[model samples]
Target: MLEIITNNRKKATLKYVRAFLFFSLILLILFMLFITGVVIYAKSKGAPPLAVPQSTLIYASDDSLIGETHYGEKRYWVPLDEISPAVVEATLSIEDRGFYSHHGFDYKRIVGAILADIKARAKVQGASTITQQYARNLFLTHDKTWHRKITEALYTVRLELNYTKEEILEGYLNTIYYGHGAYGIEAAANYYFGKHAKDLTISEAALLAGIPKGPTHYSPKVNEDGAKNRQQLILSAMVENDYLTKPELETISSQELNYTFGSTKERPVIAPYFQDEVKRLLASKLKLDQETINTSGLRVFTTLDPELQSIAEEQITQTIAKDSEIQVGFIAMDQHTGQVKAMVGGRDYTESPFNRVTQAERQPGSTFKPFLYYAALEKGFTPSTLMRSEVTAFTFDDGRERYVPHNFNNYYANDKITLAQAIALSDNVYAVKTHIFLGQDVLVNTAKKLGITSQLASVPSLALGTSTVKVQDMATAYSTIANGGVKQEPLLIEKVLNHKGEVIYESTPVKKQVLKPEEAFVTTHLLTGIFDEKLNNYTRVTGRTVMDQLTRHYAGKTGTTRTDSWMIGYSPQLVSAVWTGYDRDKTIDLTAEKTYAKEIWASFMEKAHEDLPVLPFRAPEGVVAVQVDPDSGLLATKKCSEKARLTYYVKGTEPTESCIGKAEITNEEAPKEADEEEKKGWFKRIWDWF
Candidate 1:
C-alpha cells in the first residue's frame, strides 16, 4: 500500500510540473506577439525627420551678419565629431549609464527607478535613457503620462533601430535645452562658456551636461551653487564610469571655469533696430505672424548700411544728454530707392522698445511747413510770393476756440516778408496765413500725398505743423522732394531667402509721382533757404548748424514744439530725420543748447555724405531762377536794396513786375539833383571855414 501511494504522489507531481511548463510556454508566445506588434507599429511610424528649431539670419547690405531671431528654442547644430569626448562621457555618465548596451530602454535602471518611486510614493525619478530622452525631445511631449511614455518608447525603439549609437548621442546633445534661451550642446557651450563645444574642458562639459536635468535650476548664471553640486555629481560619475581617472577628476574639478552671462555676447547683433524693422516689414509683406518670421529660418538681406548705422547709433548716444530723460529718434534713407540705410529708433532700445522712427508720432512742428509750402507752390505761388509775418488769429467754423499763432520768441518782423524769407526764418504767422489762404484742406492733402499718414487736424494749426507724424514718414517726405517729386515708399528689407537660400521675396519700391518736378524743386529750394546764412541773420536759422558742417547742396528744416524738436533734411542722395523729445508728452525746452536733433542730424549727415560726390540740386525744366526783392514778390531792379536775393520759381509763376525804389529824383531831374548836391557841398565848405 505504501509503494502504491508513493508512486501516485510521484505521478501527481509530474503532472503539476507539465502543467506549469505548458502555461509558461503560452505566456512566452503571448509576450513575443506583443513585442512583435510594438516593433511593427514603431517601424510603420518610421524615424521622425530630424527637425530642430532654427534661427532666422539677418544680413546687412554688405553681407555681414546683423542679427538673428529665434523662436522659443535657440539651437545651433554641430556634427558628432565637433563635440568634446569629455562632454559625451559626462552626458552618458549622468543621463544613461547603460546607453551603449541597451537596445532602447535599460530594464535594470527602469526596475530600480520603479522601486525608488514606490518607496517615495511619488513619480520623482526618471529612468529615460539617452535614446528615450531624444525620442521625447524629437517626437513626444514632456507630459508625465502613460500614453506619452508609450509613444516615447515606440519612438525610442525606432531611433535605436535606425540610428547608430553615435548618431543618437549627437541628436540627443543637439536637442537638449540648456537654459537662458540656449538649446543644443553647441549653443549651450558658446552661450555659457563663450567657447565652442569642441573646446569645452571636462569641468565645463560636466556643468553643461548637468543642465539638461533641470536647466533653470542648474544654470551657472542663475544658481552657481546648484550647478556646482550637479557638476560634482557628473564628474564623480565620469570617474566611476572610467571616463576619467581619480586624479584627473580631482584636477578637473579643482580648475575654475569662467562663463559669460548673456546669449548676445555669444552671437552679437549688429543693428538691432534695423533688424526689428526688417522683421516687422517681413511680417506685413508675407502675411505671417512674428513667430513665423522668427522661426522660419529665413535669410534676410536688408538695405541697412552697417557703417551708416554705426555712425547713427554712436552719434545718437553722444548727442543725447547723459543725465536727461530725453529720447531721440533717427532714420536715414536712400532718396532714389527709399531704402532705409540707417536707423536708431531711440536712445536705447532696451529701455524703450517703442520704435519712434516707425511707430511714434509727434508734432512735426515747422517740419510740416515744406508740405504747406509745396501746396502753395502747387497753387501758383512762387518762392518770392510776399506773405505777412505779423501775428494773426483765425476763427474756426467749428465751435472750437480761435487759433492764434506766433513766431518764435514773438520776434517776427511784422512786415511783408517773401515766402523764401518766411521759410528761412520759420515764421509761424506767415505759415498759418498761407495755410488759410491756400485752404487748410490743401495742406492736409499735400501731406498725405507726400506720405505723412498720421492724422492731421483740419484746423489752421495744421499749417503750423500741429499734426503728428512719424520720423520715417517725414524722411520719406523729404526723400520725395530729393527724388524729383517721385514718392517711393520707405523700404527696410531688400530680399528674403528661405533656409535653402532661395529667394522667397524681394522688395520693389512703391513709387508714384506725387508732385510736379517744378513744384518739388521750388519747394526744395525754399527748404534750402533755411540754411542760407545771408537770407537768415546766420543766428536763428534752425538748420544753420547743419549748413555750417555740410558742404554738399542739401535742403532741410528744423522744427520745434513745446514737446518735440526735429531736424529733417536731405541731400540729393540721402535723406534723414532726427527727432528729440521725452517719451511722455511733457513740454521740453529745446533751446539752442538743448536741441540735440540738429546736432545729431548734422553729425550723421556729414559722415554719411563723406564719400559721395558733392552734387548740386539740379533745377528741372519749367523751373527758373530769378532775383527778387525781399519785401515784394516782384522781380528785383537797381532801385531794390541789397536784401534782394536769388529765388527759384516755376515758369510763368515768377514775379513779372520790378520793385519801385524809394521816392527820389528822377532821371529828368538829374541836373537839378547835381545842383542840389553842389549847393549842399558849398554850404558845408562855408560852415567848415567858419
Candidate 2:
C-alpha cells in the first residue's frame, strides 16, 4: 500500500508540473503578442518629429532680424560629431550604464527600482534609461501615469529600432533642456561657457552633463555648491564606469570652471518697445496667453521700421530735458494703413515697463479742440465763422459752480475772431462757446467717431480737453484727418508665420469712412493755420518753434495743461504724437520753459521723412477756397487790409457779404439787423450773430 501511494504522488506531481508549464507558456505568448501589437502600432504611427522649444524670430518691415522671443528653452541643434566625446561619456556613465547593450530597457535596473519602490511604499526612484528619457522628451509629457509609461515604452522601442546609438544620442543631446533659457547641448555650452560644445573641457562636460537631471536645482547660477557636488558625483560615476582614470578625474575635478551668465547686456534686444507692443497685439490677435506666445515658435513680422525706430529713440534721448523728472511717450503711424512704425512708451523702457503710449490715460489739454471744432463744422459752422474770444463764464444747471474759461496767457483777443483764428490761437473761450453752441453729445459723438475712446466729461470743460486719453488714440484720431476722413484701426503686426515658415495669419487694415472728405479737408485746413506765419506773426503760436523745420505741408496742434504737454502732427503719409509730463502728475510749468514735445516731434518727423517723397495734402472735391476778412470773417473787399487770408470752406458756406470794416458796421441798414436780433432769445441772438 505504501508503494502504491508513492507512485500516485509522483504521477500527480508530474501532472501539476506540466499544467504549470503550459500556463506559463500561454502567459509568455500573450505578453509577446501585446508587445508585438504595441510595436506595430508605434511603427505605423512613425517616429514623432522632435518638438524641442525653439526661439521665435521677430523681423522688421525690411526683413531684418530685430529681436527674438523665446520660452525658457532656447535650443540650437547640432550633429553628434559636433559634441565633445567627454560630454557623451560623462552623460552615459551617470544616466544609463547599460545604454550600449540594452535593446530598449534595462530589466535589472527596473526590477531593482520596483523593489526599492515597494520597500519605500512610494515611487522615490526612477529606472528610466537614456532611450526612455529621449522617448519622454520626444513624444510624451512627464505625467506619472500608467498610460504615459506604456506610451513611453512603446516610443522607446520605436527609437531603438529606427535609429542607431549615435543618432539617438545626438537627438537626445539636442532635445534636452538646460536652464537660463537654453536647450540642447550646443546652446547650453554657448550660454554657460561662451564657447562651442566641441570645445568643452572634461570638467565642463561633466558639469553640463550633471545639469540635465534637474536644471533649476543644479544650475551653477542658482547653487554653485550643489552644482559642484553633482559634478563630482558624475565624475565618480565616470571613474567607476572606466570612462575616466582616478588621476584624470582628480585633475579635472581640481580645475576651476569658468562660466558666463546670460544677460540682456550680452544679447541686446533691438526695438524693445516695439517688440513689446507686437507681443501684446499678437496675444490679442491669436487669442493666446503670454506663455504660449513665448513657446509656440511663431515668426512675427512687424510693421516696425528699424531705421525709423532708431531715429525715434535717438531723438527722444536728445530732446528730453536732462534736469526734469518728466517722462515722455511717442508713437508714429502710417496715415493710410495705420501701421505703427515706431513707438517709445517712455523715455527709458528699462526703468519702467509701463507702456504709456497704449496704456496711460492723461489729459489731452487743447488737443481736444480739434474734435470740438470738427463737430462745429458738422453743425454748419464754417472756418470763416466768427465768435467772441473774450472771457466767458458757464453756470451749471444747479447753480452750484461756474466755469470761467480763459486763454493760456489770460490775454483774450477781446473781439470777435474767425473760427480759424480761434484754432490758430488756441482760444479756450471760443472753444467753450462752440461746445455750448453745438450740443455736448455732438462733440462726444464726433470724438468717438474720430477714435477717442477714453471716458469724456460732458461739461463745457470737455471742449478744453478735460477728458483723459491714450497717446495712441490721439495718434489714431489725427491719423483719421491725415487719411482724408477714413478711420483705420491701428496695426502693429503685419503677419505671423508658423515654425515651418508658413503664413498662419496676415493682417489687413480695417477702415471706415467717418467724415465727409470736404469736412475733413476744412478741418485740416484750419489746423494748418497754427503754423501760418501770417496768422501767428511767428510769435506766441504753440507750434511756432518747429514751423521752420517743416519742409512739407503738415498740420498739427499743441496741447498743454498744468501737468502735461503734447504735440500731435501729421503729414499726408505719416502721423505722430509726442507727450511729455511727470508720471506722478506733478505740476509742470510748460509755459516757463521751451516745449520739449514739439522739439522731439519736430526732430523725429524731420529725420523720418528724409528719404520719403514730399507729398502734399490733396484737396478733395466740393471744397472751395475764399479770401476772408480776419476780423469780420466776410468776403475780402478792396477796403480790407492785407491780413485777409485765403481760407478753405465748404462749397455753400463761403462768406457772401463784403467786409468794409467799421463803415459797414455803422451803416444805415444796421437798425434792421438790430431790430431782428432784439426779437430773438439771448442764445439765438448769440448763435445768429456768430
TM-score of each: 0.70, 0.73
Please report, as a residue range, the 10-residue window in candidate 1 with the lowest summed lDDT: 681-690
Extract clashing residue pairs from model 1: none
Off by over 4 Å in 2: 1-35, 41-50, 76-136, 139-153, 157-181, 184-265, 398-400, 537-539, 590-594, 637-641, 661-685, 688-690
Q: Which of the numbered candidates is closest to the native, going by highest lDDT?
A: 2
Q: What is candidate 1's lDDT per residue for 277-392, written digit by digit as tens?
A: 78887877888787667776678898899999989988887877688888888999999998899988887777877788889999999989999988888886777776566676
Q: Which ranges of candidate 1 are over 4 A from the true structure?
A: 1-74, 77-133, 141-149, 156-173, 177-181, 192-306, 348-351, 392-404, 413-415, 494-508, 537-540, 583-585, 620-647, 651-690
Name the lDDT value of residue 441 in candidate 1.
91
Cα RMSD for predicted model 1? 9.4
Candidate 2: lDDT over CA atoms?
0.84
Q: Rate the local accuracy (lDDT) of all candidates.
A: 0.84, 0.84
Clashes of each: 0, 0
